[model samples]
Target: MYTDSATYNALLDGFCKCGQIDEAFMLFKSFRDDGFKVGIRGFSCMIDGLIRSKRIGEAEKLFQKVFDVGLVPDLILYSIMIRGLSESRRLEDATNMFRDMIGKGIVPDTQCYNMLIKGFCDVGLLDEARSLKLEISQHDQFPNTCTYTILICGLCRNGLLGEAQQIFNDMEKLGCSPSAVTFNALIDGLCKDGKLEEAHLMLYKMEIGKNPSLFLRLSQSADPILDSASLQKMVENFVDSGLILKAYKLLMQLADSGVVPNINTYNTLINGMCRAGQVNRALRLSEELQLKGHFPDSVTYSTLIEGLQRVDREGDAYKLFEQMTENGCKPNSSVYKTLLSWSCRRRKTTVAFGIWLKYLRSLAGHDGEALKLTEEFFQKGDMEKALRSLLEMESKLADFDSAPYSIWLVGLCQADRVEEALKTFSILEEFNVVVSAPGCVKLIHALCSGGKLDKAVDIFLYTMEKGYRLMPRVCNSVLQVLLDSKDNTILAFELLDKMKSMGYDLNSYLHRRTKSLLQHHYSLRKMENVAAR
Candidate 1:
């Protein structure tokens, strides 16, 4: 019985105006399915609801769907979409739609022009706003008081106070008396321009309060009951009191009143949702952001991932991480580091390795292709090809990091390609890349085995001076090299002394063998010397 046009519009208006979207949409669907004539107001209410909820993409689709159902857009509908689009920062789209509306012979009222001009002014496009003002003035269309205030506000904000003052003076000459808002605009402009005395004089002449928000306040001409700032303040109070749902509703009311919240506001709400253990709700907000042509950044995705993990939904977290990359929002170090730790805590080896590779790739500046190729070639026992690819890739990299270089040196050592390893070491040194302890050991061992004992000793000396971590294996390997060369007896003794100082068990088999070799050489030299005597 209440599904009649008057009741339907009233219910939908009440629902949409107060931010009851779920019930509004439900009723909208039921009204249609029940064969009631859902008039133009139905579409208008739904679109307004979506826009206020920041579901701009869905609102756009609903508008098209209305047209597809054989309905044409009238002035009110066109004005709504234009206002929605312009307020959402799609200025060009709003302008193009305005042109389309005009081509169809629908004359835009002053309200429509005011919306676009306000949009232009908001984005600091004063020149474009002035031109539009001129065009409208030349036509039969008259600029309202709001239009003049918008231009004056924009000019003053852009630091063109002289022009703003001229526009303020012209307001009276053009037959539109300055409202309190108009005077406030000029006074605020003067104060912002460091003309406090002038601003005080203006305020005194206007007989308004010294405080701006307290007196000379501007109310929406169409809806003079509550201003957007009051609505926003109400929402803030609700949010501060931990009434998230209520705060969200009031925020929507502000949006319905034509004040779009900024990105920081959306982030705040999403973060609050996650903290309140409403992870799924936060995830839904992420989808709404995307639907509005706004992609979630690393923080957005990371918050949701952490929330999902807390709720024991690791699988969902991984999927979101993958989806985040697919959407082209690059992850920062904190994101991968968090994910890597998450994988480790879960004892998921594959996940940890995958995240580690991703982390390294991020550090490599999106050079995943080259990095993967180099690692793959090294794993496949193709040392020459790996070295070639690494060199080629290095030519294009503006910055050098240690991970890729360590992988190259490890591959070279494993394949016994000692010469190329030395050249790569030189390149790393030239760029001041700090190879890890494992990498230093691998290269030194390779050099000694390739009959480059002196080269190995030189690296060992440098590693010692640089305080590189010398594993027992590194000392053992250097000792073996020195023991094999009779002329290096003194160096071997010195290395053993250093090892003893570093808490190495000098009584180990390798150390004993080294000592035995040196003692045997000394005895042979003494016997030869006695025979000569």
Candidate 2:
């Protein structure tokens, strides 16, 4: 019953316009099977569909098929193909297509010229696009609202807001009112440029103008490429500037406007409230986001846990931690680390060990638990228990390393346990991780404090041989230790000279005091010699 080529072409065009490219192709194959030839319009329709769906490669292949079919495409087909190529940002190809059409004596209409001009402008070829526009106007043909909209959007996207505004004014002078598509594009551009006040003013104008048409325009335009992103930046500025009510009003507006708030938007608002120490407000926002179909993800819970822990709200933090897990969110290793760090800071050794055991048992029975517990004990200043914890778990944790072992060694050296400290050092060397600079410096200071200068010298020499850079604080602590011993006073100055050569600026007062003490001791010896004479 479908006997005409134009009828089938119309049907194919309808399919392609509705995004049914595959179905359109199927009908084309049926036409070929029935010995009915296809025209350039049907083929161009399929190409348009491919381009709309971002299948540029397939569109190109179909473009070549049109030529292979031995039918010269008309201006309509060329326009559709140019629109596809331009929208895909194939500016050069779109230009070539236009030139090819012109060479074939097919003069471009408004649609063809607009498509290529927009392509050139979108890619920042403003001069070329302007030249094309001027040529079209010289021919007594005027550009449409869509043509001005494209140029304005291109200018705005390229951050030429001033130029974009001029074009916008020109559009208004031409009595061409901006559609919702045009307004949305400008709003997005303004928001990205941080022109929030302007965006707000535009939104206000749209609302008060009773233009339900604009709302429909925005809703029906291509799904927004901007939503909730500007909400985050606005919330941050409002919080920093103490505009809490403004932030709250913006959030409500976004909700009413059907803009989906992203995770970053929720986090920004919640964390800003917490940073302001408005914990109650922060907690309420967390509940609000969750109730609005966005569950607090890992980052959200972690931020709340950290904020509560920082303010000594451990009971509240623990309750939230448990609730997070009950809500089907698994607590990560970072959560356990935060709790352990909090316990250590509060000097709750028992609580720290309990958390460590819980973390280990959760992963069955692993020796990592022992290493973590030993570090906790050392951090809480329980060296004996720390060393004991490591030793008891040594066989199971054979491959484990603990900072507590080095911490215990320093404690032993402070207790005058020379042989025990040496044994600890030997155990450390066997583990293949050399003593850290802080560990070595702590051990040297402990030895010097206990009047064991020889052992301290040996440890310092060993540290140098290992190539560890001594911190200025550690160097100062060591020199103070030597000053107490009153034996290595000369060596301390030699160390100071070395530190200076290594670019460390020792305190002028401390250096002068050390020199004065040395001079006084030399004068005492001279006085003793003179008295004997």
TM per candidate: 0.41, 0.41
Q: Write the per-residue lDDT of candidate 2 for residues 1-533, one digit (tens) a residue.
A: 33698888888876664445656777778667545788777787777767765678888888888889898888877887888888888888888988898889888877778988888987899888878877776546788788778887888888888887787768878877776667777888889999999989877766675534543554465643245765576677787786765676567556656677787777877766655445566788898987788889887888788667544567999999999888887776568777866665454534654675565556645667677887788678675566567567753454554543454454455455556666677666655557767668757776766677767766776776677666544555566666555677666666666656655555532444455655676687689899999
Q: Candidate 1 clashing pairs?
A: none
Model 1 scores a TM of 0.41
Candidate 1 local distance difference test against the native: 0.71
RMSD of each: 27.2, 27.4
User: What are the clash counts of all predictions, listed in order?
Assistant: 0, 0
Per-residue lDDT over 106-206 for candidate 1, one digit per residue giving the tens place of the 0 to 100 score: 88888888889989999999888888887785447999898998888888888899998898878778888776777888898898889999999988867
* Top model number, lDDT: 1
